[model samples]
Structures are given as C-alpha cells and as structure tokens.
Target chain A: MANTEQVKLLGFWASPFARRVEWALKLKGVDYEYIEEDIFNKSSLLMELNPVHKKVPVLVHGRKVIAESFVILEFIDETWKQCPLMPQDPYERAKTRFWAKFAEEKILDGAWIAMCSLGEEKEKAIKLAVEAIEKIEGELKGKHFFGGENIGYLDIAMGWMSYWLPVWEEVGSMKIVNPLQFPATTSWMNKFLDHPVIKENLPPRDKMIIYFQNRSTELASRPHDWFRT
Target chain B: MANTEQVKLLGFWASPFARRVEWALKLKGVDYEYIEEDIFNKSSLLMELNPVHKKVPVLVHGRKVIAESFVILEFIDETWKQCPLMPQDPYERAKTRFWAKFAEEKILDGAWIAMCSLGEEKEKAIKLAVEAIEKIEGELKGKHFFGGENIGYLDIAMGWMSYWLPVWEEVGSMKIVNPLQFPATTSWMNKFLDHPVIKENLPPRDKMIIYFQNRSTELASRPHDWFRT
Candidate 1:
C-alpha cells in the first residue's frame, strides 16, 4: 500500500508548541517535510497558512491546513492510526486532555512568566510554577509516565518542559522544580527525555541555552514584549 | 438499552462555559442531574470535584470527574455516540477544535476584557474583539451554522456569544458586534439562538443584563478583579 499524501509542517526550532507536533508525527512513524520559520521575520506562507494566530507549528496535509500544536497532534494521531497518542477509552482520553491543557495553562504559561518577568511578578510566577509542578508530581505517583508505562499523549505534550524548563531556569538564574520537592516529576522528566523519539527530536540544549540567554537579554530591555516571546 | 451510569454536572447560571456543557448534553439527549454552584460562596462539592481551578462546569460521570468545558464536551461526544458533535473526518474535527480554541482564547477572552475593563483597556479590547468577530464572520461566509446546517461542535462552543455578547454590550452601553459590520456573524447568531435546544437552555436575558450591570459596577470599583470574573 503506497500512501501519497504530501504532509508538511511549519515550525520554529525553539518553540515547544512546534516541537510537540514534530514529536507526535515522528512517534506515529509518519514522514513529513519540516520547515523551520524565523520567529522574528515570519514567512508569508506561514501567515497565509495560519492567518488567525500567524504562529508556527502549522500542519498541511494535502490541502487541509491545521494550526495550533494540540490540534495538530490530535490530527496526526487520527490520520495515522499506527501508534495511538491518545487513549482508546473515552474517560482516559478526557483525563489525558485535562492534564495536557493544565500543562499548557499552568506549567508552561507560569514558566514563561517566571522566566520573562521581573521582581514581584517573577516571584509570584515561580511560586505558581512550583505549585503546578507539585500537582503533576502527584499525578505521576505510581505511573512511570503520565500515560502509565508508555510515553503517550500527556508525556509528549509535557516533554518540552524537561528540556526548556532547565534552559529557562538557567537563563533566569532561578529554580522552580527542585528535585527534592518534586522527585516524581523529576523522575518522569528523566524518563520522558530518555525516550529515543523524544531525545532525538528535541532542539539542541546548548543552542537552546544560547537562544534563551539572548532572548532574556532582549526582553530585559523591552519589558512590554516579555509575553510575545 | 439504558444508561445506568450516574451523571452529574455542577454549573453556574451566568457562565458561558457551563451553558456549553448543558447545550451539549441536551443535543445528545443525555439525562443528568444539574447542580448550580455559587461562584461567590464556593461550594464544597465544586471545590472537591475541581480541586485545581475550583471552577464551574465540572462533569461527574460515575467515578470519573472532568473539568473544563472543552474537555467535557469532547468526553460527552465520545461517551454518547448518538448526535455526533465532532465531524467524522480527522481534518474537519481538527478545524472545529481550532475554531473552538479560538473562540475561547480570542473571542471569549476579548469580550470579557471589553465588558470588565475601563477606558483605554476596554477600547483596545473592543477593537480586538471586533477583529476576532470579523474573522468568525469570514468563517461563516456561506454557512448557516459554524457546522453548516446543523449546530455542531464549534457552534455549541461559541453559542454562548450569541446570547451573552448582547448582554455584555447592553451592560457596557457599547456595541461590539454591530449588525452592519458583521452581517454573516449576525445571521449565524440569530440562527444559533433560535435553535430549540439552545433557546431553552440559555439563562434569562433580563436577569443576565442585571447580573452584568452589577458585575460591571463591582469591577469598576476594584480594577484588579477584572480578569478573574
């Protein structure tokens, strides 16, 4: 059986959102042409493809274009039924979706604020980030992964935090996820990053550090643009 | 052929998020016990059910508890396969999810800011709200509903806007979705609200206006509390 659907992805190298889609596609054993976009000077094609957000991690399957990383991940899972990223049972799927949304809203967003902001806001964000991490620690109590024994939907969704959070902490000279405080989350992070599919696909850590260092310096001068990054 | 599983929904009357769940349940012909929660004086059950956010629109099915309207909607659709809220095709489902996310992040959030804020912020939010609505108007160019003919996932997700936006406008004494500017959106709003399930489930208009009026007054007094509501 020869499948001939032209699958393409527009992504930024440092964007966790883009990386999630890339990982999902890779995990499903689906071949895709990846286009790295310059976040500073976004391409016209990127804008045309995702007019609403004009953000990266846009998936184009033949003529159908899908933007937003979560949406794209689900699309990949459904389009290629080989390795299921989502669970089969409805209840399990819902729980997975709930935690994934939490990762984005609480953990990721809080980490961004902690990294990008200054003084009171930074301290507040750090506290919130630690709280979110602790909650996830409880979720990973006995399970090896968020999706028990396998790196399923939630593991992929939250995998970027393992690499990026460390980079963010270094760039900010702050500690949010203390190993002693969040041992379970720390263990899960180690397990998730150790996975071949995830380990191979992540942006280079050294490069990410340099990138964030530059971004942090840039954001310091322009506080208003902290969130845009 | 009977559903014996215990189903319950904890919701708030004025919340668009809660209304979305109610509409979804009615569309699927699912019978469930509805418990209204007081947002001011928090209930123990609401807090226990949704320990993280402690927000309304928590769906308890047997032993499983699901929070967040979008997550609950997906659960409802998957659990009861009768009137399918999501499209059968992967591509179409992806698009619907994208728009539903857009509705929450852009339209709903923008509308909140427009109604809650004062002076410059309100004006800026109003501009953004119009832009989001105009985008949706373009999406509804030739379609009767966001789902086309039938009110599907997106229509249910964004349906609250048809009723609540008008109430916000009346309370604020400002017009965001002018009939002249967004004809297609205006038409779709009418069609959506006219749907029997939607019409029957929505909170009373006059009561909503009074509620928003009081809320706007309170928000005006305490500017910091604007976004939380």
Candidate 2:
C-alpha cells in the first residue's frame, strides 16, 4: 500500500519528536518534503497546519494534516504498512504502545522538567528523571532494543535519549542518565544512534549542545517555585 | 476472531477510567468477569497485573495483562474488531487519537487539578478546565459524538467528562461546564449517558457523587502548589 500523495513534514531542527517522524518515513522508504521551521519565529504554514498545538513535526499527507509525533508515526505506519514500526500481534502492539507512552509521559517529560528548574527543584527533577531512566533500563534488560532486535515504536519514541540527553547532561552539569547506572539503556541508545537511517538524519551534535546550553541558562533565570503535576 | 480466553477487569467501582474499559467490553458484548477493587487497599491481583501504574482499570485477557484505559481501549478494538471504537481511515484514526490524548492530558487532567485546589489557584484551574471543555465543544459541533454518529475512540477517552465531571462540578460548587457554554458537549453527554450499554453499566449516580465529594475534600486538604506541566 504505497502512497503517491505528496507527504510533507514541518519540523524544527533540534526537536527529537520531529526526528521520530523523519526516521519512520526513511525506514518505510516514504518520500516526503521536509520544511524546517524557525523555532523563535514559527512559519505561518506551521501555525496554519497545526492551529491547536502550533508545534512542529506535523505531517501533511495530501490535503490532510496530522500533528503530534506519535500520531504521525502511527499514521506513517498505517499508510505504508512496510518496514512495520509496530508488531503484528495485538498483545505485542499494546505492549509497544504502553512503553512508547511511558517514554512520552515519564522519561521525556521528567527530563524536560529537570532542564527547566534550578537548585533543590532541579535536584528533585533529576532524581525523578533518574528513577524513570532506571525503570526503562530495567525494561530494556537482555533485549537489543525496547521492541527486541530491531528498532521499533518504543525505540523511536525514546530516540531523543540517544542524542539530546548528553547535551542535557552537559548543559545542566547533572547526570540525567549515566551509562554506568543504565548499562542496558546505554547499549540501546548507542544501537539506536548507530542505525543507518537514524545516523544519517540526526542534526549536528555541537549545534544541539549549544542550543540546549542556552536554553538551560534561560530556564535557570526563571523563578523555580512550581510543583510537578 | 473471538477467543474462549477468560477476560477479567480489575476496577474501582467509582472510577471513570475503569468505566471506559467496561463500556468497551459491553459495547462489544464480550462477556467478562468484573472485579470491583478497593482502591484504598488494592488487591494483589491488581498490583501483580499492573505493577507499573498500580491503577485501574487493568484488563486480563487469559494470561495477557494490559493497563491504561486508552491503551486497553485500543487493545479491545483490535482484539474484538466488533463495534469499532476507531475510524477505518488512518487520517481519521490519528485525529481520533489526537483528541483522545487531548482529553486525557487536558480536559480530564485540568478538571482533576481544579477539583483538588481552592481559592485563586482553584479559580485559575477552573478557568483552564472550562477552556479545555470549550475546545472540545468546538470539536463536537454538528456531531453526535467526537467520532461523528458513532461512539468511537475519542468518545470513550472523553467519556469521563460525561459522568465524573458533573460530580466534580457539583462538589466543588463550580459551573465549570454547562449547556450555555458547552451546548454540544451537554447534548453529547446526554446521548452517551442515555445509551443502554453505558447507562446499564454505570455505577449508581449517588455513589459516584459521594466518592468524588470525599475525594475532592481529601485533595483540597493536601498541599496545592503543583505546576500544570
């Protein structure tokens, strides 16, 4: 079920969420026009396509627009049905989605919170982030990846950890996820980063580090008095 | 594709999340055992099945265990393939999942915060909750349900609003949502509640109200200084 419909992805350069969609497209051999969005000054096209969230990683499939990275990944898989991102079995699919959702709701979210705080709050955030990382590390034990041998939904969902996490650790000067503490996760991360398609698509590492360094400084200046939801 | 595997749902009677799984099962007419859990003191079965969240509702299909209402709903739809909860088209399915996610992350989460707060912060939370409701109301315009004429994935995801929300509103003495502000949502709520499957399976209204009232009071007494995330 190959689609000839023009598929375009609106993305920000340093966004790992956007990378998930890009990797899925490349893996499925789907050709899509990629338009990079200026984060500071978002394009009218991006705003128009995703009015609700107004965030990027929006997939324009023919006349239809789909926002949200996970949603786009699912759409890509369903539309292409080749180099399948999800497992064939229902139980396996559910488990894959569950972990992917955990990646979104916990691991990624916790790291973000940790980045946007200072002092005691930042310490607490880092602690929680480590806990989430440890939980995921346990889940990855003895498996090549979260979904077994090949990179799949859970791997794509947690892809950010492969590249962006080091930047986060360097910028914040905190051990968000150490290879020693999370050996399984470290192995999986290296494996994900080394994948041919993923390796080719990732943005330059130096640029990502600088961007997050600036972001961390900006967040540190803000009043750190809010509780985690 | 029906199997003879024993299906059992571990749920707290007053939980709207649990009700989502129950509704899906009933809608599909898949006979399963219902075990009402004591939420305060969870059962070993519930803990063993869903060690990750340790929350209801957990679906046990023979030896397989699945947790999280939205994830379980997707599983049920896939396994049964009867009374489809999701749309057939991939684009439509993505849209449905998008809104269902919005319902979980915003509407339900926002309302929970509002009910758990007091004074000015509570007022702010209520305002945000209403905004989320209004957004959904806009989405619901001219459709009987979020998925159009049929009750689908988005409807089940947002089903908590139809029943649990009213109790929250009344207990909190807040007009967070009403027909004047959310005419479409109100109508949809009535339609959903009137459906035989939903109506028959819903816990007693008085019981729900009391449970929520107690819950709201308990939450209000707790420290209320959390970020919205």
lDDT per residue as tens, model 1, A53-83 = 8998899988989998889888888888887
Please report the candidate that would top DockQ against the real structure.
1
Taking the tens digit of each residue's C-alpha lDDT, what string does model 2 give over B1-229?
Answer: 3367999999888888888999999989999999988878888877788877788889999899998888899999999988899999998999998888877777777777788778987788788777777778888899988777778888888887878888878877887777987899999999998888888878888987787777777777662432211
Q: What is the TM-score of each candidate against the true structure?
A: 0.96, 0.93
* Candidate 2 local Cα displacement, residue A67, angstroms: 0.7
For candidate 2, what's the TM-score of chain A, rounded to 2 decimals?
0.93
Tell me the DockQ of each model, to 2 decimals: 0.91, 0.82
Clashes of each: 0, 0
> Please, what are the lDDT tens digits per residue for candidate 2 over residues A34-135?
999887787889879887778888999889899889899999889998888899888999988888887776767667767767778778878877877877
Worst 10-residue lDDT window, candidate 1 chain A: A220-229
Report the TM-score of candidate 1, chain A only: 0.94
lDDT of 2 at B104: 77
Model 1 pairs in collision = none
